[model samples]
Target chain A: MSITSFIPPQRTLMGPGPSDIYPQVLQALSRPTIGHLDPLFIKMMDELKQLLQYAFQTKNTFTIAVSAPGSAGMEACFVNLVEAGDKVLVCRNGVFGDRMRENVERCGGIAIMVDNAWGEPVSPALVEQALQTDPDIKIVAFVHAETSTGALSDAKTLAEIARKYDCLTIVDAVTSLGGVPLLVDEWQLDAVYSGSQKCLSCVPGLSPLTFSEQAIAKIQQRKTPVQSWFLDQSLVLGYWSGEGKRSYHHTAPVNSLYALHEALVLLHNEGLEQAWQRHHRAHLELKTGLEALGIQFVVEEAYRLPQLNAVYIPEGIDDAAVRSTLLERYNLEIGAGLGTLAGKAWRIGLMGYAARNENVALCLKALESTLK
Target chain B: MSITSFIPPQRTLMGPGPSDIYPQVLQALSRPTIGHLDPLFIKMMDELKQLLQYAFQTKNTFTIAVSAPGSAGMEACFVNLVEAGDKVLVCRNGVFGDRMRENVERCGGIAIMVDNAWGEPVSPALVEQALQTDPDIKIVAFVHAETSTGALSDAKTLAEIARKYDCLTIVDAVTSLGGVPLLVDEWQLDAVYSGSQKCLSCVPGLSPLTFSEQAIAKIQQRKTPVQSWFLDQSLVLGYWSGEGKRSYHHTAPVNSLYALHEALVLLHNEGLEQAWQRHHRAHLELKTGLEALGIQFVVEEAYRLPQLNAVYIPEGIDDAAVRSTLLERYNLEIGAGLGTLAGKAWRIGLMGYAARNENVALCLKALESTLK
Candidate 1:
C-alpha cells in the first residue's frame, strides 16, 4: 500500500495505440486547466471541430470529440442512432466489429451480423446480402480499420452500399482516420468515429466523432431518448456547437481536448495525404525488413492497414517471450494479437509521429537483434 | 480555417470542478504516452485501483477509474446496477440529482424522484417515505455533494435508511470525495462515483468509481446486459482487475490515469482528514470575505460544501462582466451558476490544491477590486 510517485519509463510506443505522441500534443496536455465554458476554451472547441472535419474529410457540422475513448465513441454512434427494435447490419471481421454487434444488442437493437474471418476485410458482397436479407435494417455498421487484426475494410465501398440500401452507415475509423484515405463527404458515411491515440498520436481518452445530416436526423428523430445521456449527440451539440455562446453538456475534457487540438494541428501542418503516405511508406519499409526476417503478415497486402501491421508469431517462437524481450531490451512496444488472434499474431504499428523512417529502421534493427 | 497553435492562458482555476490542479498532476499528465496494455502501465493501473480504494475507504475489488468524466461515471453506476423494469428511488435537489433520474430512465428503470428545492440537501425522510411507499425500489440514488448548489446531503443516513428498506445505495461523490468525509465501508454505501477534477485536483477527465460488494452482486446477477459497452463495469473489470496479466477492454486513458494517480498520491500523502480541514478553513475565510462584501451564499452553513461555495450576485451587478473582469484582470476563473441557478449565483471552489490560504485570500482580494 506504500505507493510513491510513478515516473513512467520513456518508451518508443509502436503499439496498436497510443502511437508515438508528438511532443507538441504531449505539452498541450499539461496546459493550465481551463473551465469548460471559458470563452477561450470555447474558441478552441470550434477550431477542434473544424480540424476534425478536415481529418475526417466531411462537411458534417455535427463533428465533435466524445469525452471518452474510441469504444465509447463507437457506443455513442450505436446508442444514439440505433433505437430499440431497430435492425442493424453489423459487419464482424475482428474485435471492433464484434464490439459493434455488442453495442447494437445492448441498445436493444437486433444485430444481423455479417461475418468475415479474422485478418480479412469485411466482404462488401456479404454486407449487401445481409442488408438485402434484412430489408428493415436501419444502420449498416463496420470497422474501417480493424486494429485487432490490422485489416482495412473497404469503407468507401461499404458506405456506398449502405447508402444505396438507404441504411445509415456507422464506420469505426479508429486506426484509419489519419493513416488512410477516408472521405466522409464523398463516401457518404452517416456516422464515423475515431480514436485520438491512433494516427493522430494524441493521448488516449478523447474520441473524435462525426455524423452526417442523415445520422443527425436519425438521432434527432429518435423514438426513445438516447440510452447514454453523456454520449447523446443532441445534448452534446449544445456544448460543442455555437455561433455565440457554447452551452454546457458535461465538462469537456479541457486538457485532453488541448492535446487533440495539437495532434490535429500537427496533422494539418503535414497535409492529410502526406501523413497517410508517410504511414504507407513506413509500413512498406517495416514490411520489407520483417519479411527479410522470415515473418509473415496475417493480412493480405491489399487488405492490410498501413498504420498497424499484424504478423504471425514465428512458428515455435513463444508470443510472450518475444514481446517481452522487445519491450524490456529495446524500450519498444508492439501489440499482441487481441481476441481470436491472441498469441498467433503481433501488431507492429507505424502511426502518426511513429510513422517515420527512423522508427521503422529502429524497429527493424531491434527485431533483428532480438530474434538473433 | 487556418487555426494556429493554441497557447492557453495560465489562469488560477477556481471553478466548480477542475479547481486548480496540482502541478505534480499536470507534470504527470505530460509524461510519455505508453501502451494501454504495456506491463508497466498495467502495474500503474493496479496501483491506481489501490489508491482509489484508499480514497474510497472501501475493500471492494471493483474499484477503478472510468475512462470518462463524472457524467459517464454516473451513467456507469445506473446502467450497471439497474435493469429494465427495475424501480429506483432518485433524490433530486440540484442539477446532478435530476441527471440521476435521466440515467435511471435511460437504463429503462422507473425513476421515482423525491424532489427537494434547489440549494437544499436531499431529505433522508423523503427518501425513506419513497422507499417505503414503493418497496419494489431496488436502488436509492442521491448526490453526496451537489456541485451546482454547494449542498451536501446526508449520505450516511440515507444509506442507512436505504439499507433498512433493502435497497442498494448509489451515491454521487463527485464534488465530495477528497473534500468531505465519506466512509464508504462504514456507511455501507453500495456504489459511489467521483470526478478527478473536483476535490482530487487532477485534470478534468477521469472518473474514479468504486462499487461495494452488494452492487457487484447486483451487477453479476442482472438478467440484462449493461446498456453502454464502454461504461459496462463487468467487462471493464477484466481489464482493470487481475493478479498478473490484465485483459484488454477499451484502451484505458493512459496519460489521464497518470494524472489521476498523481492526484490520488498527493491526497494519500496529505491525510484525508487534514485535507478536509484545509478546505473547511479556506471556505470559512472566503465566506467571511464574501459576507463582508454583501454577497449572500445560496446554501445554508449547515448543509454547505466546503469545496464549492455558491453565492448570489449582488443587486444589479452584471454577472458576465464581473466574471470577465476577474478573468481578464486577475487571471482567476470562477464558475457561473449552472442549471436553475444560472446567472443568479457564482460558484467559488476551494478544493484540493486550490484549498489554500493564499488562493482564498487572493480570490477575496480580487473580488474586492473587481466589484469596486
Candidate 2:
C-alpha cells in the first residue's frame, strides 16, 4: 500500500470558489509555520483583523478569521447571536440562505424563512413585510451575494429594512465581500461572514467574520452558552483580542492565516473599488462571449453578481459531459448549478486574481469548444 | 491604513505543537490551489484517507481529516457519539482532558470526571473504578499524550477497561500519533482525533479523525441531530466517502490537506515504529542535556511523553525572558506552560521533523545561553 506524493494538475478555476490564488499568497502559505501564540503571529492577526475591517468597510473591532471554512463562520454568527427560542427571519433565495435557516434551527432558534425564486435577488419589500408580520423576529439573515445563483441582493436596502424593524441583521457576504459593495457599517450589518476561498482568492479553509456592537451585546447577554465550543465567538474573542497575553483557543492555522494576510494585503493595494470594477469588467467580457455563443444568464442584469455568472445550460447540452470535457481537455473548471438549478445552470466565476481578461478569454474559448 | 505583505522571520519551532515542518511539506503547501470538488482533488482526498489510516494503524474506513483544528475534531467526536442525556466518564489529567470534559458538557452529555494530578498520566485503575461505580456511563474519554504536561497515559489499558464496562472510548491522540506507539484497532478506540500540527509536523488547521464501527453505529443510532452543522461527522462522511460522486460539504482547506498528505507520506516512508523510536531518542538526548543544566522534568520518567517535554524553569530564571531570548536571539521558539503549569514550566517539543539531533543540539545550546 505505497502511495506516492500527489501532484495536482494546474487548472483555471472558474468555479464558485477557490478561484485563482495570487502567487504571493501561495508563497505566503509555504512560509515558516510559527506558534499560534507567538507575538509576531499575534501582530499579524491584529493586522489581519484591520484588513478584514477594510474589506468589509466596517469599523467593527470584532473582525477576525474563523479557523474553519465559510460554513463554520456562518455557524459562529448564528450560534453566538441567535439564542434558544429566538426568532430569526432567514431570507432564502439560494443555497446559502437555506443554510442560514439550518444554522438558526440547529441553534434552537425558530427560523421564519422568507423565500424567493432561485435566481432572483432577495426582495427588500418581502423582508419588511415578514418582519412586520413577525415582530418577534429578533434577527434578519440573508446572503448579500448568492454564489449558488449569481444573484446579488441589495444588502444596503435589506439591512436598512432590518434596522427599521429594530432587528439585528446577519449577512452572508461569502461571495460579495471583495467582488461587490458590502459596507457592514454603512448597512448596519450586525453579524457578517465571508469565505477566504471566494473573492479573496486565498485557499479554502478559513472564514473571515465580523460582529457589530449590537451583535456583541446580544452575545454578551445570552442566557444559554453557545452550543458549539469550537465556534463560540465569546471564548474565541479572548484569544483574538486583548492587549497582551491572549488566551489560547484552538490552534490558529498559522500558514493559512499568512496566505489570507497576503491576500488581504493585495486587496488593500488594489483598492476595493478598483477590485470591484475589475470583476465587473471581466464579467462584461464573459457576458459578451457567452451571448455570442447563445448562452443565457440565469439572473437579470440588474441583480447579477459581477464575480459569479450563473447561466442556463444550453438546451440538449449534456451537463456532465461538457464540464468533464472542459476539465479533461482544457484543464478549466466551471461550477455546476446547486440545489434547484442543478443540471440546468452553470456558474462561471471571475473572482480576485481569477477576475481577469485572460481567465475570461480562456473560459469562453473552453466553453465554446466544449459545447461544440 | 497602509499595510504591506507580511514576511515572517524563519524561526525553528520547538513548541509543544506546530513543531518544525518538513521542508517538502512546506513546498507542498505552496502548490497551486484547486477547486474542492475537482476530481483530481477528490482523488487526493482518497489517498489522504489511506495515508491517515496508515498513520493511525487502523482499518476503520471512517478516517478523514476534520476541516478545523484539533479542538473542533474533539467536538465532532463528542457531538456525534454522546447524546444529550448520555453519561460520559471524562478522565482529566491535563489541559486536553479538561477540554474534553468541556466538549462533553457542551454536547449536553453529563460529564463524570476522573481526576489525576496535572503532571501524572491517567490511572487505568481509577478509570475501572469509575466505570464500576457508574453503570450508566456510555463512553470513556481520555488523552493519550497530554501536550500541556508531557504525560503519556495508558490508552490500551484504559480502552480495555472501557470495553470491559461495555463502553466506547474517545481518545485524544493529538500529541501521540506518529510520535509514539498508538495502536487504534488493537486498543479498540471508538473515536480518536489528532492534530496535523503535532507529531505529523504538518501545518495547523486540520484534524485527522477516525471512528470505529461501534462509534459509527452509536452516531447512526443517535436520537438527536448533531449540534454543529459544520462538525457533524455524518454529513461530512458523505463528502469524504463514496466511490464516484462525492458530496460537497464545506470547501476543504485544500493546501493544508496537501501538506498533511505529504507529511503523512513522509511518515509512512519512515515507518511509524521508526518515527516513534526517533522521537524517544531525541527525547533522551534532550533529557540528558537538560539534566546537565540542572533542569527537572515535570512528568515522571516512566510516563513522560517523548514528544513534549515539560521542564521546571530554573530558579530565578524569568520564564518569559528566557522564551523571548530564545525567540529574539536564536530565532528559536519553545512553548510556555499552559493551565496548571503556567509560569512554572517550559514545554520543549521533539515531535516529527523537530525530533532530530540538530534541533536538540540547537535547542540545548539556545536554552543554555538564554539561561546565562
Candidate 3:
C-alpha cells in the first residue's frame, strides 16, 4: 500500500472521456502545486483564459473554467443568468439538454420544453416554433454534441434562429469543443460550456465556459442574486480575471489548470482544422470497422458526431455482459446508452488522444470478440 | 508546443492542498478512462465509499464525494440541507467559516453569526450562548480545521453541544480529515465535508461528504425540495449508493476518483493512527525549527492544527515579496494570509504526503534564505 513511483501503462482510450491523456498533459499535471492565487499561477490562469478563448473560438473576455466539473459550469451559467420568472426554452434531445431544463427549473425560471427524439439532433425548426410561441423567452438552450446518442445538432443555425427571435442561446458543447468545428463568434452564440475530459484530453475537474458581452450584460442586470455564491460569475471573475487585483474565489484546481493548458497547447499545435480532421478520420475508420462487424449507428449518417458514435446493440446481446467482458477480458472501456437508449445502444467515443487508428482497431476487435 | 513528457522534480510539498501527490495516486489518475457508469467503475465507486468511511472513521452509509471541489461540498451541504427561512448558526473564525455564512445566506437561510477573531478557535461558550438565545436554530456550522488561519476547533465538543440543542451539525474538515485525529462516530457528528487534496493527498476536484442517519432522515423529510438539483443527495445517492442498480448522475470525473481511491488506499495501508502521529511529529519538528529561527505561530500552541501552521510576518518585512522570492527562487509554494490576516501571516501546510521531516526542514531553510 506504500505507493511506489507510478508507471502508467499505455492505453488506447475510446471511452466517453477522459480520453487518452497526452503524455505531456500528464507531466503538466504532475508539476509543482502552487497557490491558486500565486502570481505565477495567476499568470498561468491568464494564459489559460487565452487558451480557452482560442479553443472556444471566441473573443469573449469572460471565457474561463469554473473550478469544478462540466455540471458545475452548467449550474454556474443557469444560476447567474436565469432569474426567477424568466421563461427559458430547453431543447431536450439527450441527457445534457434535460439537465439544462433542471437548471432552469431550479433557478426558478419557467422551463419551456422543446422535445426532440433522443437520437435525433435538436431541430432548428422546432426551436424556432417554440420561440415564436413563447416570444417572451429569454434563453434558448440545446446541446451541440449529445453524448448520449452521438448526435450533433445545428448549433450555428439554432443560434442564428435565437438571434432572430431576440433570445440568447446557451449551447452545451461538452462533447464537441476541440474535436469538431465550433464557431462561437460566427454562430453568434451567447453562452457555451465544455468539459475537459472530452475532446480536450485534459484531467476532468475544471470546466471551460465562455460568455458573450451580451450575456455578461444580462447577468449584471439580474434582479435576484445568484443562489450559489461559489458559482456567481460576478465574484468568480475577480479570481479568474487576469488584472493584478484578483480577489479570492474558491481555490482554482491549480494543477488541473496546468493539464488544461497543455491540452489546449496541444490542440493549437495540431491546429483546429487538423484536429477536426483527425476526429473525422478516426470516426470513419471506427465506423467502417464496426459496420463490417454488423453494428448499426444510432444516429443517422448526416447528424452523427465524429467524436462519439452511438451504435445499436445487436439483438439478444447482453449490454452489461458485453461491457463487463470488454473490461475484464480486454481492459477496454466504452459508454452505455443513457436515458431512452439504455440497454439498446452503446456509445463509442473517438476523442482527443483516444481518437487514434490503433484505438479504433483495438475497440472494434475487442467488441467483435465480445459479441461473438 | 507538444509536451516533452518530462519527469517531475521531486520536492518537499509543504504548502496548501494539492500537496505532493503520491506516485501511486498519479498512476491511478493515469489509468484508462472508463465510462462513468461502467459496472467495474461502479465497483470502484463502492470501494471508494468504503475507503472514505475508513478515512472519516465513520459508519455513515451516506458517504460520497461531491463531484466538485471543497467549495461545492460546502454549497452541497448548505443548499441541500438548509431551505429558505431556516435559521442556521454559523461560526466564523476564518475564511472557510465565512464562506459557510455566504452559502447559508445564498440558500435563503437566516445566518446567525457566532463571531471569533481570525487565528482563533470558535468559542464553544459563545456557541452555547447563541443557541440559548436562538433556540429555533436548525443547523450549527463551523470549520474543524480552518485552512486559511490554521485554527483547529473542538469538533467533538461543538457537535455534542449542537446535538444537545437539537440542531444538526455541519462540520468543515477540509484540512483536518487525514492529517488530524478525527472521530466522526465518537463525536456523533451529523454532516461532515472534506477535501481530497488536503490531508488525503489526492488531486483536487472530489469533496468527500458523510451524513449521519439523522441528517439523511431530515433531508428525506424536507418539505421544500433542495434547490440545486446537482447537489441534492436524494438524486445523487441513486448514482453513488453502490447498490446493484446504479443510476447515472452527471458523468463523474472518472480519473480523479481513481487518484482519490489510491490516496485512500495509501492512508489505509498506513493506519489512521499512524498517519495522525506522522502529522504531529512533523508539526513538532517544524515548530521547533521555526522557533529556532525567531518565528512565532499565530494560534496558541494548545489550539494549533498539526497540518497547517500560521506564522506572523515580521514587522516591516514585505510578506508578499518574501513569498514571491521563495516561489521564484526555490520553486517553493506556501499560502499567504487570507481575510483579516492578509499581509500579516503565512500559512505553512504539513498536509498528507507533504507532512515529512524533510519538507519541514526545506520550508525552514527556504524561509531563512528568503529573509536573508
Candidate 4:
C-alpha cells in the first residue's frame, strides 16, 4: 500500500511515443490547477485551438482537443460523422489503420477494407481501386504516420484519391502532426486526429482533432443521432466551442489542458518547420549510427517516417531481452515492432524532445554496448 | 499565433471537482514520461491497482484506471455492461447521474430514471420503488457524490435496494472515493467509477474503476458484444489485468498514471479512516468559519458532502463580483453551482490535500476579506 515518490531515471526515450518530454513541457505539467471554464483558462483554450490549426495548417473552426487519447480521437471522428449503415473505406497498412476499420465497424458503418503490406505505406493506387469497386463509400480512413511500422503514407495523394471518389477523408496524424508536414486544408482532409504526446512533447491524454467544414456538414446532416452521447460532437461542441455560455459536457481535465497549451506554445516557439527539421536531423544521425552497427531499417527510405525508424532486429538477438537490458541498465527506451513485424524489428523514435542529437547518440552508444 | 507560457496563478482551489491539487501530486505530474507497456511501468500499474482497490475498499480483479477522464469511465462502464435494449434504472440526483442516463440511451439501453432534487441525496426508497415497478431493470445506476450541489447519497443503501430488487448496481463515486468512505465490497456494488482530481489530488485524466466478480460474470454472459470497441472490458482487461500476454490497448497516459499512483499512495499512507476524518474536520472548520460570516449551506446538514459544500448566495451580495474579487485580489477559486442551482449557490470544496487546516483557514479568510 506504500509507494515511493517517482524519481524517474533520465531515459533517452526513443519509443514510438511518450518520446522524450521537453523540460519546459514538464514544468507546464506542474502548473497550478485551474477551473476549465475560468475566463483565463477559456482564453488559453481558444489560443490552443488556433495553435492546433497552425500545427495542422488548417483554418477549420472545429479544431479542438478531445478529452482522451488518439484512439478516442478515432472513435469521436467516426461516431460523430458516420451513422448507421454508411459505407466507409478503411485502408490498412499498419495496426492503427486496422483500428480505423474497427472504429468504422463499431459505428455501424459498413467497412470496405483496402489492404497494404504491414511495414509499407498505404498504397494510393490500391485505395483508388477500392473506391472504384465501392463507389458508395462515404468516408476514406487511413493512418498518415503508421506508428506500428515507421511508415509515412502519402496522405495528400490518398486524400486526392478519396476526393476523386467523392468520399470524405479521415486521416490519423497521431504520430505525424508536429514532427512532419500536414496540410489539412490543402489536402482537403475532412477529419484529422493527432495525439499530444507523440510529436507535441506534451503529456499524453488529449487528442487534437480538426474537422473540415465538409465533415461538420456531414455531422449536422446525420439521419440518426450520434450513438455515443458522450462523444457526440453536437453536444460536446457546446462545452468546447463558444465563449461565456459553455455547457458542461464533462469536467475537462483542467491541468492536463494546461500542459497541452504549454506544449502547443513550445511547438509554436520552435516553429513547426524547425521541429520537422529537428526530427529529420535526429533521424539522419540515428540512422547513420545505427547502420554503422549493422542494423537495417525495415521501412524503405522513401516511405519511412523520420520521427519513427523501424530497424530490423539482428538474428540471434532477443528483442525483449535487449529492450529489458537497455531499460534496466542504460535507461534507454526504444519501441518493439508491432503486429507482423514484432520480434523482427525495433522502432527507434526521433520525435519532439526525443528527436535530438544527444538522445540519438546516447541510444546508439547504449544499444551498441547492449548488443555486444 | 503566439502564446505565453501558461503560468497558472497560485490559487487556493475550492471548486466542485478539481479540489486543490497537492504539491506532491504536481511534482509527480512533471516526472519523465515512460512507455505505457514498459516492464517497470507495468509493475507500477500493478501497484496502482492495489492502491485503487484499497481506496475503493474492493477486492475485484477488474480494478484499474481507464486511460481517459471520469466521463470516459462512466461511458466505459455503461457501454461495456449495458448492451442494446437492456433495461437500466438510472437514478438522477445531479449532473453526473443525468450523464449515466445519456450513456444508457446512447448504448441503446432503455433508461428508467428515478429523478430527485438537485441539492438532495438520491432517495433510496424512490430507486427501490422504481426497481420494483420495473422488474426487467438489469442495472441500477446512481451517484454517491452529487458534485453539482454538495449532496451525499446513501450508496450502500441504494446498492442493497438494487440487490433486493435483483438488479446489479453501477455507482459513480467520482467525487467520493478518497474523501468519503466507499465500501465497494461491503455494499456488494457491481461496478464503480471515480476520477483522479477530486479526492485523489492527482492531475485529472485517469479514471479509476472497479468491477466485482458479479459484474465481470455479467459482462461475460452478455448476449451481445459491448457497443464500444475502445471501452470493451474484455480487451481492456487483457492490458490492465497484468496476467498472461498483455494485449495492447490505447497508449496509456504514462506520466498521469504516475501522478495517480502517487496520489493513491498518499491516500493509503494517510489511511482511509484518517482521510475521511481529515475531510470531516476541514468541512466542520469551514462550516464554522462560513457560519461566522453568515452563510447558509444549501444541503441539509445530515446529507452534506464533507468535500463539497454548497453555500447560498446571500441577499444584497453580488455572487459574480464576490468570486471575481476573490480571484483577482486573493488568487482563490470556488465553483459556481451547476444545473438548477446555477447562479444560486457557490460550491466550496475541501478535498484530499485541500482538506487541511491550512487550506480551510486560507479559503475562509479569503471569503471573509472578499465579502468585506
What are the lDDT figures for the candidates, one per model? 0.91, 0.93, 0.86, 0.88
Per-residue alpha-carbon lDDT of candidate 4 for residues A1-372, written as tens digits (9 for 90 to 100) = 456666666677889987788888888888888877677777778888888899999999999999888888989999998887999999898899888888888888899989988888988889999899877898999999999999999999999989998999999999999988998998899999999889998878889999999999999998887878767888888887856667777778777788888888888888999999998998899889999999998889998899999999999999999999989998888998889998899999888888888888889999999999
lDDT of 1 at B350: 92
> DockQ values for all predictions?
0.84, 0.85, 0.40, 0.70
What lDDT tens digits, residue by residue, belong to model 2 across residues B229-300? Answer: 998898899999947688877899899999999999999999999999999999999999999999999999
The lDDT, on a scale of 0 to 1, for candidate 2 is: 0.93
Q: Give the per-residue lDDT of model 2 (tens digit) for A262-347.
A: 99999999999999999999999999999999999999999999999999999999999999999999889999999999999999
Summarize candidate 3's per-residue lDDT along A324-359 as a digit string, tens digits: 788778877787888889899988989898888988
TM-score of each: 0.99, 0.99, 0.95, 0.97
The runs of at least 3 residues in candidate 4 whose Cα sits more than 4 Å from the true structure, single-residue gaps closed, are none
lDDT of 3 at B133: 98
Clashing residue pairs in candidate 3 are none
- The alpha-carbon deviation from the true structure for residue B88 of candidate 4, after best TM-score superposition, in angstroms, is 0.7
Please give the lDDT score for candidate 1: 0.91
Full-model lDDT, candidate 3: 0.86
- TM-score of predicted chain B, candidate 3: 0.97
DockQ score for candidate 4: 0.70
Q: Candidate 3 on B1-372: residue-level lDDT in tens?
A: 233222334444566666777777876776655666666677788888888899999999999998888888888899888999999999999888889999998888999999999889999999999999989898999999999889999999998899889999999999999999889999998889999888988877779999999899989888877888778889999999866688866778777788888899899998899999999999999999889878899999989999999999887889888987877777777887888888998889999988888788888899988887
C-alpha positional error of residue A267 in candidate 3 after TM-score superposition, expressed in Å: 1.2
Query: Considering DockQ, which of the candidate structures 3 and 4 is the better prediction for this target?
Result: 4
